[model samples]
Target chain A: MTDLQITVNGDPRRVPGPASLLDLLAHLGLDARSVVVELNREIVRRPRLGDISLAEGDTVELVHFVGGG
Target chain B: MLVDGPFASLRVTRDQPSFTMTRLGPLIFASMSTTLEPTELVDTPLTIGGRHFRSRLMAGTGKYRTNQEMVQAIEASGAEIVTVAVRRVDLDRTKEEGVLHHLSPERHFLLANTAGCYTADEAIRYARLAREAGFNEFVKLEVIGDRETLLPDTAGLLSAARALVKDGFSVLAYTNDDLVTALRLQEAGCAAVMPLASPIGSGLGLLNPYGIRAIKRRLEVPVIVDAGVGTASDACLTMEQGVDGILMNTALAEARDPVTMAWAMRHAVDAGRAAYLAGRMPRREIAVPSSPDRGMLA
Candidate 1:
């Protein structure tokens, strides 16, 4: 298993093994219903988010959006 | 008998430069003789998620001091598509006068944005909440990963865009001005791509026309010039570069006169698009005029 370290919300997070984007979201405890993800500054569609695997040393950002006044 | 009324002595000036002055009298209007007509403007009608719009000028329903102002501004801007970010009908925030009371769904399409989420999953969750709150199928997918810059996390953005598209949501992805990143989002099936001119509230104008143009040229989806607009001229410049549309908030919202600025942007967009389609004459090393050569006798 490849060791993965990615920046989530500007903090470096180290997780064991290469994980799919779904796993990362699960680890973050985010409901698939309330978030959007960007991988290396590119938008990834939700359907493929479950399938796309994270590589070692990947720069990932997770964005959560809620309605504001 | 002289009647005292608003139009008591409206006179026609030969060339009143200002809009209000020019409208003082009934004058013969010319179609695109000097300034371009909105009807004859360039950039083909854009179809996103089955909604076809002739004008690419998009308006947002925010930052207006009054709802009446928003309505007037929307009409003046000639924007067919107006975006409204959905919020919980904050009844508590306004026990006497509600915040959501300012907007009406009958006027325009409500574009629900996940404004505060920190990840793709979080955005999706908000999207569902928005839909459940009766916002319909359209979502303005904004996956902002940074609070300081408010930049869309491309990884999270792409992830959310794909998810939303698959789940039957018409996603209008708000992205940064990166061609490669935009292409990836387009490939992920976003209904439209909205790229920022600069940071969200900077109003710095179009920071990279070439990059936006490249994205407009390469992507099959509509390219909307979103954010960082300071004036009508800025919007026009973007339209001239072949953008499908312009989405602005702070520029008009913070202008000296929001209504007038909205109309100015509308006309500027129509004029610039017409100029682009009419094709600008190449900039020459020397002046070239359509007149007989002065030194022909030589």
Candidate 2:
């Protein structure tokens, strides 16, 4: 599989091609249940993560609640 | 974040120590008893944006020594509504970093926040992401204008509140101690307006009692004082201003004993709220004797 360039949380990273959002999360060792994903400004629901494929130069943002005041 | 909104409530366990503590809480703070006074009925189940919360004090899950400590402190604080910030998950350290790993959303109603955003658009984005995380619609909207003080940009805050409210969010705006801005937030359809007691993380305590009181007096929605509370008295004083509730972090997270301080805060908030409802005695210029003049001994 060819590697494609993508942005995850604003940092450029290369991942194997033909990857869905769920595959991308797995590549990063992230549990899909724990974090929420936003691809190109649209939130990809957990179940739809596997359905949406990562494109070249896709902007992905993975977020979760952290400790803050 | 809790899967269910109002359904997630604190769980009661039969564990020995916690059980004893829970039972003793009433005896320790009997004056600030959960059972309301006859005149002051219906203080519990603080309703906001159609959600109900038993606690008026809300604790943050930040700056804690450890996750275990944070959990203990939050538990001790007796806060049903807890605030969490939305941020990009650190990709490098993918070890159970979510606050959810420690705090149970089932026990505490999660109130997501946009703590670090500086612009209205940025705050709105964060709030949307938080909502998409599949919790409730509540967001503690903050658009900080000053990095030094972490004071909110009233303009940005108002814009974000309006946008989020329009998007069907229960916007809980965190602003400064300004009645005009607070009123604007209320008008913007915020479920609750949170005015800071002082600068964020400053521990300067309640800087303007009258200002907070003014907002509480004018706003029809709940006015919750957030930030800058250093001690139990600070929490008490802020609550005594007639605000609906208070949300604090450093006061508990930074205390020598965060758990004890959290416990103190729980009592303080309850006491302050009760006092506000009970009302205070009028201040007199001259000394007034409790004994009657006719009963005074010659």
Best candidate per TM-score, number? Answer: 2
Per-prediction interface RMSD in Å? 9.3, 0.8
Clashes of 1: 46
Backbone clash pairs for candidate 2 read none
Per-residue alpha-carbon lDDT of candidate 1 for residues B43-82, written as tens digits (9 for 90 to 100): 3455788877656677776777777787788778867666
Deviation from native of the Cα of residue B273 in model 2, angstroms: 0.8
Reference-based lDDT, each prediction: 0.71, 0.86
Give me the runs in candidate 1 sitting further than 4 Å from their true place. A1-69, B1-29, B32-43, B94-103, B294-298
lDDT by residue (tens digit), candidate 2, A1-69: 999899999899999988999999999999998899999998888989999999999999999999987
lDDT leader? 2
- Among all windows of ten consecutive residues in candidate 2 chain A, which has the lowest summed lDDT? A38-47
Candidate 2 regions exceeding 4 Å error are B1-44, B295-298
Cα-lDDT of candidate 2: 0.86
